[model samples]
Target: MTKIAITGASGFVGQTLAKKLIETSPDAQLILADVHQPPNPTKSSNVECIAADLTEASACQSLVSRSPDAVYILHGIMSSGSEADLELGLKVNFDSVRNLLDTIRVERPATKVIFTSSCAVFGRAAVKDVASEADIVPYPESSYGTQKLMIEFLINDYSRKGLIDGRVVRLPTIFVRAGAPTAAASSFVSGIVREPLHGQESELPVDPNIGIWLSSPRTLAHNLVHAMNVPADKFGHFRTVLLPGYSATSGEILDALEKVAGKEVRSLVKEKRDENIQRVVLSWPAKYDTSRARGLGFTEDVGLEQTIKDFMEADK
Candidate 1:
């Protein structure tokens, strides 16, 4: 059976990805782990759920002791959280990942590792409206983005050395995400819908015209699973792939919500801009030349209106 281990299995995306794997790879052994004990997404006996402090090398060693064929390194602090607490972000995002990589190198040599990164790695100043993986070195403005870039470099070197097979997929903002407001600067992208639906006020921290690249929970999960299944030989010297997503401005997203959920629900959204959040959010590239990733068979999102409609129907 193909054994898979997913760290940060408690988060929204983590839980969604786990469910996708269970549906597609039922016979595979699923190891769900997080600092907070993870609930099995499917509640299936075939899965193993464990609480792990990955910052502690011992916990990482134990997680890899089972020798998973593939590992999804999914845990990290959100953008604003990392920027607010430098030490904490470094510990959780950068240092812990390196610790996990070390353990994987020793115990599960050559195991495929699928890592989640963000589009925030590209600073607005460096990117000339559109970014492709080949043309630029990341110039991250936020601490969180810097941490992701650091980890990406490490993953690339690790893969190059043949220590492990790594695939780093940089993500666009995921909208209509199910859950409470997160520490992510991009959380507002989801909040425009999530809070409004629940009769809570949502804030628009950035200008309405600011563009955001986005995907749905369904698409992100599918692409992540596909990343693990890809042949290692298919990846070039660089291991990172920027996933495909369409760009829409903040006004466009709000309009989509109004179209799907009606004017009443949309009215709950309030404009309460915060400069720090805006600066951090603006650093991310709003559009990418995803031709490389598309050719590799990664999925793109449906339009914003359809995505919002799907969330409303499913969530209600």
Candidate 2:
């Protein structure tokens, strides 16, 4: 049986990924680790949930002790939260991850490591409406982005040295999460859809025309799983990939929401701009050339309308 370990398994994205893996890979055993005890929603013996504070060296070693064939590194502070607290961000997002890598290097050498990074790693200088694999150079504009970038380089170096087989997939803002708002700068992206659908007033922090790159949680899990089975040679010495996602403005996303739900539901969104949030959100590149990722067996979600419809169907 294929054994996979996923850190941050208590978070929304982590839980979604775990569910997806269980649905798609019945034979795969999973080790779900987090500071809070991760739930075994499936209640199957194949899935193991552990309470772990990964910042601790012992915790990292213990998680890696499972000797999984692959590891998905998904734990980190949200954008706005990290941006607000530099020391905390550095410790969790950067130092803790480095410790985890070290544990993997020693305990599970050459294991496949799929890390979920963010498009925020690309600031205004690295983008002009569109960013591609060839022309892009990351200069993170926020603490969260900076932390992610540092880990990206470490993963690349570790992979180059054959210490670990690493694949860094830079994620776009994930939308329509099935929970309350998070501390992320882009939480409003999902709030506008989720809150209204659940009969609550949603906040719009950016202009309607401000565009952002986005992916659905379901599609992201699929691509992350696909990343593991990809041949190490297919990475061709550079293991990082910008996961495929479509770009759309706030207005367009709300329009899709309206189409999926109704005008009354859409009208529940209340616009109240926050300059800091806008500045942070605007720095992220909304479009990418994901041909390289697609070539490596990655995939993207359909359109905004379909995404909204899917959320509606699932929320029911």
Candidate 3:
């Protein structure tokens, strides 16, 4: 049977996307390539885990040996970590991608690739209201965003050469993120509200007025799946497009938190500004046009309140 391969299979987005693929595409097989195995094994026989360090040359080659029909590249370091650990970021985020793409060129040119990029690619918003798919001139202000945009362009160039079918979906900062937080700079966005609601004190890294492009994990998972299945003929060529998201200020996020968690729990969010975090957050697009994604059948979460409710319900 034809298989689907995914890197960063153990990550928040990767794990969620894997479960979604199993539930939605029962017949399709999945080969998970990550340095770590899935925390919870899939009940489906179609899911197989391949724990390998993608940054290593040999490991990447071994992964491509499976010859999957489609591949999902979801691995990357976060902004803070990338800045702190430049070497590690270069290895995992940059070199790993190059090695994997090289392996794909040699081993499986026919494999289609869906890359999960980020809205961080656009360093500044050109307009006050919304950005669009046409505004792809990446002015990445941080190491992580720069690397992601680099790979996105590489994928586009590879597609131009007819090497493989490549698609890039620029994901917004996902909210109500499940599980424990990792190194992501935007982790604090969810953390401030999520932790406080669970009776834990959380720190705010930026001001309440800091607006960002936001989406729910469920919507993010849907978009990743949609990217893989969208008819090739419908897209014209291998392209990169920013997905739709609700443009919400941090105060708006906290307001929703208060409604769901009550006054006492909501008050636990302690503010401590970090200039580094603020610098990064301020550069990102405050809004996006996203009409293209909507026209193409991609949808957004039902508003911030419902997203918070979904997070609470899922935690139960």
Better of 2 and 3 by lDDT: 2
lDDT at 112, model 2: 88
User: What are the lDDT scores of the predictions, listed in order?
Assistant: 0.89, 0.88, 0.83
RMSD of each: 1.2, 1.1, 1.6
Tens digits of per-residue lDDT, candidate 2, 211-293, equal 88889877888887888878999989788888899989999999998887899999999999999889888788878888888
Clashing pairs in 2: none
Model 1 misplaced stretches (Cα beyond 4 Å): none
The residue pairs found clashing in candidate 1 are none
The TM-score between candidate 1 and the true structure equals 0.97
Per-residue lDDT of candidate 1, residues 1-316 (tens digit): 9889999999998999999998998888899999989998795688999999999999999999988999999999988899899999999999999999988987888889999998888887655768888876688888998999999999999999999999999988888799888898888899988899888888898999988889888788899999997788788898999988899998998888888878999999998889987877677777889998888889887888888877878686
Error of 2 at 162 (Å): 0.6
Q: How much is the lDDT of residue 156 in candidate 3?
A: 86
C-alpha lDDT (0 to 100) for residue 135 of candidate 2: 72
Tell me each candidate's TM-score: 0.97, 0.97, 0.95
